[model samples]
Target chain A: GPKVLQIPSHQIIDMGQMVTLNCDPVSNHLYFYWYKQILGQQMEFLVNFYNGKVMEKSKLFKDQFSVERPDGSYFTLKIQPTALEDSAVYFCASRSGTNTGQLYFGEGSKLTVL
Target chain B: QQQVRQSPQSLTVWEGETAILNCSYENSAFDYFPWYQQFPGEGPALLIAIRSVSDKKEDGRFTIFFNKREKKLSLHITDSQPGDSATYFCAASGIASSSFSKLVFGQGTSLSVVP
Candidate 1:
């Protein structure tokens, strides 16, 4: 099975501070995505990136959130001046261009805001 | 509005019995449906998926029964085992264009397979 790796399995940060989560997607994957899940809730779509541009984003993707995969390196999600509600497990997923619609997700990076 | 919905937030079934998980969607544009299984502390993994053109899909002991007209589906796990105890998420996506399709997930149904 393909694997997506997320860094900083757990992190605790101040509410007003900045945080960045990194994701290393599968080698041949072309599309990358970010999803948010609070405790005992459904996984909410944040944003999806492809070919160096944001393909689609949900309302949950606030203005303070941004994503980039500079030079095909680690795909990163940055949140500036985070809010308490921003505390959740962020999962990164990637899939090939094929129409199978199978997205391989990472173990998830759990963020805690105090 | 939750586009995808699942019933019975929690369920318990004895080993070797058939566990049925129900799911429904509000969007008619959604053409692809996939079910994901998740264990604690791990990401959800794709269990099985079915396209709109198909009425049913089976993989080993897992089967998905889809009703296009009703916009609903269900996952049946036969011969359930204790290891099958996990959260199951029903997800849907619409292929509107050549670009990638994003998946919307349900709240999930937690199943406990009693041995």
Candidate 2:
């Protein structure tokens, strides 16, 4: 099983501060995705990125959220001015473009806003 | 409007007993269904998957039975073990059928298997 690494397994930040969660997707994977999961809630799709551009994003993806995979480096989700509601476990996933979008996910980064 | 819904938000089973997790969907266009297993401090791993083309899929002790007509599906873990105690999620996607597809997850079922 391939592994997707997420930096900063747990992060506690003050509300209104900027936070960047990094995901190292599986090697050779093309389609990258981010999902948010509130405690005791379903995992919600946030956005998907490919070819250095965003393919589609859900309504949960706010204007303050952005993603980029710079030159095959780590795929990052940067939230400007984080809000209290933004506190959740963010999971990153990736799949091969040639495959059926069977996603592989990272452990997740838990964000706590105070 | 939760497109994908899971039932029995929590369940407890004894070792060697079978566990049944149910899920249903609203979208008829969806043709792909997958199950994910998650443990504490770990990511959700792909457990098993079934497509609209098939009514059932099996892998080891895990089985997925899908009903296309009713748009319902279920995961049955046979002879479950204590290690099988974890949260299970049922996810659907039109990824294979449509170009614009995203994986949508169910609320999740937390299972506790006692030894």
Candidate 3:
């Protein structure tokens, strides 16, 4: 079974500050995704990445948010000038192929924007 | 437009009882459905999955009953145990679209199994 790992499992940042959440997807996986879940709410899609570019993003993926798979290494999601609404558990997931239809998710990064 | 919808927001069952969680989808093109279970402070994990080609898929105490025509599905946990308590999500996706593997998740159902 493949596993996805996230760095800085919990992060607290001041409003208007910048934060970068890192995801280490399975070594052999090709597709990566980010999702957000507010307290007691359903998980919502943020963005999906493949081939070093964003394939699709939801409305929740704000303009201040950006994702990159730099150097084929870590898949990072950066949020600039964070807002109170940004408080949530951020999840990173990956799949071996596009049609496998099963995603392996990381423990998640809990972001608290004050 | 929300694609996947789940019900019961929460459920409680005694040990050895059966727990059922419901889900429905709006997309007729969605052929793949998977159920994920998550414990507090942990990520979602795949519990069971069923394709539209089949009506039922079972693995251990976990089973998924899918109705392709009605675009509905359900996860049944038999002989439930205290450890079976967790939040379950039903997700759907198409086969070949760019969002092929992208999962549209249900709100989730919180299940509590009493000892």
On lDDT, the leading prediction is 1
**DockQ for each of the predicted structures, in order?**
0.74, 0.72, 0.70
Docking quality level of the chain pair in candidate 1? medium
Clashing pairs in 2: none
Off by over 4 Å in 3: none
Among the numbered candidates, top DockQ falls to 1
Residue range A1-114, candidate 1, lDDT tens digits? 889999989999999999999999999999999999998579999999999999999999999999999999999999998999999999999999887789899999999999
Q: What is the TM-score of chain A, computed separately for every candidate?
A: 0.98, 0.97, 0.96
* Number of the top TM-score candidate: 1
- Error of model 2, residue B58, in angstroms: 0.7
True contacts kept of each: 0.68, 0.72, 0.66
Error of 2 at B89 (Å): 0.1
Backbone clash tally for model 1?
0
Deviation in Å, model 3, residue B91 alpha carbon: 0.6
Task: Write the residue-wise lDDT of candidate 3 on B46-92 in tens digits.
Answer: 99999888999999999999888888999999999999999999998
Query: Looking at model 3 chain A, which ten-residue stretch has the lowest summed lDDT?
Result: A94-103
Tell me the fnat of candidate 2. 0.72
Q: List TM-score per model, in order.
A: 0.98, 0.97, 0.97
